[model samples]
Target: MADIVVRRVDLGYFVRPASETGTEHARVEPTLGYLIEHPIGLVLVDTGMGRHPEVDAHYRPRRIPLTAALRTAGAKLDDIEYVVNCHLHFDHCGGNPELAGRPVFTQRSELSLARTTEHTIPELIDHPGARYEELDGEAEILPGVVIVPTPGHTAGHQSVVVTRRDGTIVVAGQSHDNASLFTGDVLSQRAGVGHHPVWIDRLLAFDPRQVVFAHDNAVWTPGTSQVSAS
Candidate 1:
């Protein structure tokens, strides 16, 4: 099998407070997406943010439309054969509507919540010709590339695992806000000190060489215990 190539797509940046309290001040964070060049076809993870009045008022995301973002990654909207959303959050699945008939994989639970709850903008989802392939659990949507449920930030959140000759790379979308938090969770699990999700164990089993984040540009290298661009 050919090696799967994973490229980061820079969607744009947004400013938000580090903590809920205004005392912490605001921090600038980048919204990221991933483009996977697979032998089967091109697969996209997350579609960047969508535009809405309420959404804008809240996040105030400086937008980079999916088309522009994809282009930066040497891909195009038409080139994407399938999409796997980490979750149905507005920032994660905003471009889902533009995908139309393309297969967009998401956990059934996540889809149900997105459709019913006030968590995300309704117009961003259930758009014209929206086709959702809801999964009950982990699924190998593409050969050597699988979607594993890693619920932490959200009940039905998922992450993409791409197996390469070097090692596995996990595209953890908002799994723990940042790679450091994920590292802490992993360390806690190792020590058996506190609660950690079952999915963390599953991810550790893969022995990932590098773990990437959606909002963070840093790559978590477990062996070195350091973050790098990689």
Candidate 2:
């Protein structure tokens, strides 16, 4: 099998409240998305930021609009053949409404909540061109590209597992806020001490070459060291 390429898309950033960050003061964090350049087709993960009065006041985001961001990544909005939302948060599914006819792979539970509750921007979820392929569990949407349920950030949160000939890459969208938090979970799992998510073992089973995040720029490698940026 040939190698599959994954590129990072900068959706933009937001100011997270101190309460949410567990810090003395608020912190600015980047919102990231991934572009999987598979031989079969282009798969876009997370669609940047959704806008709303309340959400805007809370996160105070500075978005890069999906088309512009994709352009930076050498892709066009029309080129995306499939969409995978890590979860239905406002920031992740911002561009989904524009994606209209494409097949969007989302967790059944996540979709349910997004529709029934105030989980995300309702317009984004039930727009005119929305077509969702709700998955009950893990599914290999494309060759060597798998969507595994990593529910913790949300009940239906998921991470993309891309297996290439050289190694594997896990696009863990908000599975933990950043790489450091993921490293803590990995260490906890290894020592069998701290509380970690059940799916931690499953992700480790892939022996991922590198792990990326939605809110952090750093990439997590197998060793103690970290890749500052991709």
Candidate 3:
């Protein structure tokens, strides 16, 4: 089998309140996507922002076209055979139209919610010929790549886990806002903190070598090993 390589695609940045504290002004956060080059085929995790007046007013997103973003990662729109979204949030699946008819993997519950509720921009979710492979739970898309249901940020949110000879890397799309939050959860589990999410335990079972985030560039490795962004 050929090696699996994961590359980060910078989709552009957006400004939002730095924290839950509503008083403060906005701060910029990077909107990131991932390209997984696998022997089976190429998998894309999250498409960048989509265009909508409401969405534009809310997040104030600065986006790079999906094609250009893919090019930056040494890939192209035509190269992606499959797509997996962490969730159906406007910022996450904004570029779905670009992959029309492609098999986009997402949790079934997420699709249900995206359709009925006002959670995400409706236009982005139901683009023309949007081929979606709705998953109920965890399922392996390829031999070494699996989409795990890691619902916390959203009801049907999912994360991608890529296993390699070296170790495993979890492309945790907004699983937490950043690696630090995920690290805290890991530490909480190690300390036997009360009543953690079942998915957290499931992710811990993978014994991941590194964890990547969508909003932040920092990487969290096993133990206290962390690769901070420069």
Per-model C-alpha RMSD: 1.5, 1.2, 1.6
Q: Predictions ranked by lDDT, top down?
A: 2, 3, 1
Q: Could you tell me how far off, in angstroms, the CA of residue 163 lies in candidate 3 after the best superposition?
A: 0.4
lDDT of 1 by residue, 186-212 (tens): 888888998777789998888999899
Among all windows of 10 consecutive residues in model 1, the one with the lowest summed lDDT is: 15-24
| Local distance difference test, each candidate | 0.88, 0.93, 0.88
Which is superior by TM-score, 2 or 3?
A: 2
Task: For residues 171-216, write the lDDT of model 2, one tens digit per residue.
Answer: 9999999898898899999999979999999999999999999999
Residue 88's C-alpha lDDT in candidate 2?
94
- Over 1-230, each residue of candidate 3 has an lDDT whose tens digit, in order, gives 87899999999998886464255667788999999999988999999887788768777889989999999999989999999999999889988998999999999999999999876888888889899999999999899998999988889999999998888999999988888878777877888975557788888788998889899989988867455662
TM-score of each: 0.95, 0.97, 0.95
lDDT for position 18 in model 1 = 50
Q: Which residue ranges in model 3 land beyond 4 Å of their true spot? A: 18-23, 225-227
